[model samples]
Target: MFDIYLPIAGMQFNALILVAIGFSVGVLGGFFGVGGAWVVTPALNAFGFPMAYAIGTDLAHIFGKSIVATAKHRKMGNVDMKLGLISIVGSVIGVEIGARNVMYLTKLGIAGPVVRYIYMFMLFGLGIYMLYDYMTKDKRAAAQAAKVAAAARAGLAPPAKKSWNLPPMIHFPASGITISLWTVSGVFLFTGYLSGLLGVGGGFIRMPALIYLIGCPTAIAVGTDLFSVLFSGAYGCFTYGIKARVEIIAAILMLVGAAIGAQVGVTAVKYIRGYGIRLLFAIMVILAGISVSLKQFQLNTASQWMVMCAALGMCAVIMIKLYQGFKKEQAEKAGYAVKEVKP
Candidate 1:
């Protein structure tokens, strides 16, 4: 069972660590409707795994986790099968190009810095934007509510419009919106490229894009994102595996843990509101950005402690999110009981 040792590193197989990492990633993945590959790849790299092996192993684990999450989301009627299928073709092509670029960068001895820099920029930028958006939205909601109250005091009704005026709009029975296909395709292309470049499941980006850009409801965005990730991640894993880039044992161990974690995450989703999900996701991304930035420092300074710090920070974020999710679930249940007693 421990036959495949890392001769260069002089380390034996540690199945327990792999399982723990997988389980943690799975919980985050399910809760945020993400693939969790971002967490897995960096964590593995911190453990002294080569970049190629880490990415491949992470992909395999994501493939399995995606399957579980997608199934759950599908049951909840969140998946848009047609859109997911179309996105798969684009995701496959993007992954191939991105994987090739990774190999090229590795050969040039610059992959680590380049990847870390990209991660730092993307994560931090997105995190800031999401945080800003949430804050502005809260203010806007408060203003709107106040306006409505004033109108009631004046004996006038609030606005009756339940829609907006967006051009070239077409109705989506699933989303119940008249959004443009151009908007959808543009988002998917970006999502596909990001998934390929970062070796992530792309749900982190896709969920927001779907809700904000495409005007899908939060539940639909989460569900549809999982459907897209299921295919995209499987394709990525297969491509990497065929190239012998995958570590099957590591991937399997992570998947085993992720499977259980995914279930817990999915259950927690029932209790979390849309704004709450966005806030949690933004916080996670910011922490992830910090972790990747620390990794960049490790690479530049050749500091083992920095690398360990990055790994610990990331794991801490995951664990915190998981605890918060469970807490939210419990709070919701307690609220229900209080409501029942009130009546």
Candidate 2:
């Protein structure tokens, strides 16, 4: 009953599947500040969509979903406008380059496997690194504290973290980071290229880059990455449309679900703290990588189920957290009000 014709992709796809995928990804995108393409592309491929078409359709939906997520993030004061704007320049350029490379791979008839393998590698590598970062955060903090104490005992100031002092350093007041312009450009360019090649919103890559590389707080990184995603998604949509790779019908269906899910996801971020977000993201990424790997092994059905299950499970966790946090906040407000009335 939910199946619909997709002229662009020349297939009859289930509308319910599209919407469900969009909804789950929307929640993830909003909370994680990612484009949700990593999950969407793999999910679509598992369901028999051509790799190129999956990437294109995923980008189209991401453009719409990002608008909702970004607006919400801005209201919460999570966006770093200056840094986001700077990222757009380098990202757009890198995206074009990556897109061109995909077209070349398509001509060689190896785009599907090539893209999937790259996705697997990147997902595993990034997820493991982030997990390590989260695991050792306390140890790192203690070491820094010890250094400060030793310095104090020696009657000296605490030592500074070493950094590049390249010319034309730019300061982002929102993130409170000052670094070389060259550094920012390099980071975004690399992230953008991956986005183009992988058919992702590049938020997954850029979000962490913003945190570890650019030194933005986790929430700020999430918000700022979404801001950059808006532009990249738009460009990806247009370019892919021109190449006749986008499935418009599927994209619209997905957008309908994403719109609603984005609201819930963005709200959840308000309740979840930085470390909490990071840890959850790490787990999700690793699971997603495993799903993609399954697809590479020709277990398409298994891959589809795994990714869908992961998305649904994560959504449940996020919603429960949101509910609990909302209740706690309400209780606190009630207590404060009662005290004020007594006075």
Candidate 3:
């Protein structure tokens, strides 16, 4: 009853697993403002899905998830439509080129090892950097708060605003900052290519790039990233679909769960601090890196059990992130109520 392709016992898959994985990835994606395709693609591959089918199905699911998350983030006043639109154009071109590149790599018989190694190195490096940044930010915030307290006690004015003199800066009405368009375009181009090459929606990289490089606030970055993903993912889905790489049934099932999870994730963001978000993201990415590394090892050794274990480990990491985010949200709410009553 739950099977999608039962005619071929060796290759048939259960629908329940697809939905569950989708739901889990969706929650993480929404909360972290990422495509979650990294987790989805590998998970599908591990489950006896062909590489092409997995990429296509993952993109389709990402398109749906991105639409839902974008709407939610827009409602929260987090998206920058103009920036997102510009990024989309670049992303589409990049995806096309990336798809072609992947095909070329496959022909050369170097796709698997190259992709796996790149994923491991990039994921691990980014994860470590994020964790370190989160820790340092927390410490800095504490120190700043103490300084502000000391100044308050002394009845002195706060520090003067720092100034920079630069011309040709364009104003972003949404961000309330004047920045160079060159910087923005460069980021978009890089993110676009990465999205295309990795078969991801690019939210993971785009969101952070917006926040750090473009200097957009976290909420704005989340919204804008989702908006960009909406376009990129749709294009990705269509491109891969035309190649007969997508699995419509699998995509639909995953989307069903992801859409709902996205709403929950968007809501959760309001209750968590930015550092908290970074910390969770770091942990999840690190776990994902570990899982991928394990799978690579398993493939080298021809260990079926190890491969399965690695897949399960990835799922567990995602679940852990959800639980932690939920717990943090609840704690924040309780703390807020307590403070309100005391005051």
Q: What is the lDDT of candidate 2?
A: 0.90
Q: Against the unseen true structure, what C-alpha lDDT does each candidate score? A: 0.73, 0.90, 0.74
Model 1, C-alpha of 209: deviation from truth (Å): 1.1
Candidate 2, 91-165: lDDT as tens digits: 988888999999999999999999999999998998999899889999999999999999999999899889997
- In candidate 1, which residue pairs clash? none
Q: Could you give me the TM-score of model 3 versus the true structure?
A: 0.77
lDDT of each residue in 85-162, candidate 1, tens digit only: 756666666666777888888999997778778778888988898888887997888989998999899999986546
Question: In candidate 3, which residue ranges exceed 4 Å CA deviation?
Answer: 5-12, 93-115, 141-167, 295-343
Q: 36, model 3: CA deviation in Å?
A: 1.6
Q: State every prediction's TM-score relative to the real structure.
A: 0.76, 0.90, 0.77
Order of candidates by lDDT, top first?
Answer: 2, 3, 1
Q: Is candidate 1 or candidate 2 better by lDDT?
A: 2
Tell how far residue 336 is off in model 2, in angstroms.
Answer: 1.2
